[model samples]
Target chain A: MSLCEAEKTFILHGVEENFRIDGREREDYRPMEVEIGIISHAFGSARLRLANTDVLVAVKIEVDTPYPEKPSQGKLDFFVDCSANATPDFEGRGGEDLATGISNSLSDAYRSSKAFDLKKLCIMKGQKCWKLLVDILLLECGGNLYDAVSLAVKAALWNTRVPGVKSVGIDGKNVELNVSERLNDCVPLDVSGAPVMVTVCKIGEYCVVDPSAAEEKCSSAALVVAVSQGNITTVLQGSAGSLHPTTLMDSLGLGVEVANQLNIALMETLQSAPPHFDVGFLK
Target chain B: MSRKELLSKIGLRADGRRAQELRRIRCKLGVFTEPDGSAYIEQGLTKVLAAVYGPHQVRGGRSKAQYDAAIVNCQFSMAVFSTGERKRRPRGDRKSTEMSIHLKQALMATIKTELYPWSQIDVYVEVLHADGGVYAACVNASTLALIDAGIPLKEYVCACTASLANNDIPMVDISYQEEVLGGPTLTVAALPMSEKIVLMEMTQRFHLDHLPKVLKEALRGCKDIKVILDEAVRNHLVNVGSSSGWVKNK
Candidate 1:
């Protein structure tokens, strides 16, 4: 999707005027739709579509020994898969670099205890604990991938339910856990503190949130800010272009402001969402 | 471990489906705008999404381009969380590579590649859930995607899986549980309109005498699937056409 020089200048002028190509203001976001518990086989799952960008997230839990260094804490791992269906460029191993970058940023954002507590996922100290594997699939890329993926991940984690442990038996060197068989005997995850990322793109002296693919191309640099409970968790600088110190700080501020608003809106939608239905891609 | 019956006394399968009945198939076309054509299909518990791109100039290098016919490229992938157990990788495994090759073969049989010389067509299928018959689901989903892409094809290509329930009774559309159980499964991809078999694969050896019956059942399943896909395509066209006012006169 290479842009011509004149086309780039057109986008630049639009940003300067604070009116985007899609007739949106600099701070406004595109329409988004979120669906939870769409994947029945997964412990938790979510699908989010921010304009044309689509992300699907699923969380699977397994019982495993805790990390030796973090014996008292459970584990949370993030894996991102770039499906070729999203674009032919992502075929074979072409998407690995992008997938790894997204997953790494997600892990970094969730590393802080204030963002997402790991102790709550612990089952029995160092012997056995629950491990949550968050798998994210990229079905479409309309730009603003960081923000879309993070929101989907948070929604999926919010929908996750950990099966209750009936009892734990320990004998010298062996530990056995009896998981409850009842479907409703489960503990839902607390995702109030989950971080939500916002990508603030610096386009022609102005900054914007949720840039469209074309807007993303016009931007020189971008800042990804992951906000959790009104606090910044992780900040990443993307693209090869350099940002001035003042501009970087300004973009950071904008990112946090938008992220907070997004978090509130996400919570409202999740809480008001009805029970699971079969409205996935069919809709 | 005690063996469970694949079919009940009254000829019902483990999932309460009759031997000839297929799992519920719900599908939608043009699910995404990024690709030239995209589709999502759910065959019972198994779900698959497919997207088709091009009939355009060959990518990567021109040396790979064919002067006589377009190169048909296919990639088969499964979401890491698609299976009961989490998968470590989505694609690039031996099984996925084999599936990709098989998909390409099936699609090539139906697609009119000679119409676009020195070009390429990319078909990608992603399995969101793998209850059973993943390969068949992929083929079915890809066919819809190609059609949505407006690619030229001789006829619709449909795939199905069949197995011998009790060494005598043949069953169509085997589920994951039945596949896990001991049984010989046969997969067939065919053009139902022309009654041409594009590809056939079998797992676990069965009596050669029973091959004809199993193959017949699998082909029948393919024909049935074709009907369903045809109906879906017509419904999609009618909706799209009327919405654009192109079919208003009719």
Candidate 2:
């Protein structure tokens, strides 16, 4: 992703004009394509392609006893896998740092009870709980993984169809569950407040949104802000360089403003998604 | 795990496929914009994506360059959510290492290595979902990616799985259900036109008497898969060639 001097100048001038090299406005997000239920075997699955950045998210549920500290609530675990297909550098354990960072932020974003409720996932108090593992695999690294992964996570959650429970019978110490009748019934997960992360990269005294590979190279530092329903969930300042508190605040404000529009488009995109639409790499 | 339980009384497998039938295959090439060649394939529930880069000078070390052939480097990784339970890591695992080695061996046999002497070609494959036939899918995917990269090949390298079921019947392209139920799973990667087996891995044991039929079924499955892959390649080339204005000039 090396940038020549001329190419760097062109991008800098474009940023000064508030128009990115891709012709996107400061608050505009690249066109994103999303598909749900692409993976049949997984309980819930979605694939999101934002320009060239591609992400696939799957939700797998398992029954387990709740933690003693949180007996009544269920569990939400986020796992991110950066595959080598994205780049040759991520062949071995090289992508662990990026994966761990993304997963941890997702965990924190969903920790808020308003964003994702874990209580409804409990099958029984203290005894049985549905542990949902939201696994995200980064297939491509065109750019902006946080946004792509977050949007795909929200879509996968929406597409999730929790199995219907028929009835439960508890006898002396034995519990017999009868769940055969409501096989077709399903419950969609609540994801209205799902957070979407927007990254603001500081390049040459100016801040830009959705910086591509070349732009990222010139930028010495960046900040990632996760916004949920107009509120800032978390802010992650990244790069080998440092950011002052004032610059951090400025980036957070920009992330918030851009994320509001980003969230609206994401919600609309998911809502207006065409069912039976062919979703794959060709498009 | 009994011999009779390998297949049902109705002559159907655990996933209800006939002994000679193969799972459905769906694939798309050029899935990404950055890679020189990329493809995504689904054989039943097993989904794999492969990206090819090179025919250029080797990266990392030049000492590994071949004198009169291209150095083929391959990496095979499966997503943590690819299996029934989430995996702790994607690569460096025993199964993944074996898969990578098998992929490189099969691809090296098919690619025209002499044309790019002292250069390197990289084929990276990621398995998004693993139900069964992972090895076969990865081989097929890498073949398509190589084709997408415009790298010449001796022939289409195809792979398939075979299993012995119900003592007499042989199953082609065994699914996850059939794979775990019982019997032997024989995986073969072959250059379809040359009918040369590049790599063959067999798991479990079946009587020597059943070997012929099961091996034949697997070969038949490989040939079938070759047909599908060949058609895809032709269509893709046509689309790419025409869209590039070559036909207009002609």
Docking class of 1: high
What RMSD does each model have against the real structure? 1.2, 2.7
lDDT of 1 by residue, A129-202 (tens): 99999999999999999999999999999999999999999989899899999999999998999999999998
Fraction of native contacts under 8 Å reproduced by each candidate: 1.00, 0.63
**Segments in model 2 whose C-alpha atoms lie over 4 Å from true places:** A166-181, B1-17, B248-250
Tell me the tens digit of each residue's lDDT in model 2 across A74-145. 899998988878887776887889999999988988888887889988777777777888889988888777
Worst 10 residues of 1 chain A by lDDT: A120-129
DockQ for each numbered candidate: 0.95, 0.64
Q: What is the interface RMSD of each candidate, in Å?
A: 0.5, 1.6
Query: What lDDT would candidate 1 get against the real structure?
Result: 0.94
Q: How does model 2 do on interface RMSD, in angstroms?
A: 1.6
TM-score of 1: 0.99
Q: Number of the top candidate by TM-score?
A: 1
For all candidates in order, the CA lDDT equals 0.94, 0.84
| Superposed model 1: Cα runs more than 4 Å off | B1-3
Worst 10 residues of 1 chain B by lDDT: B1-10
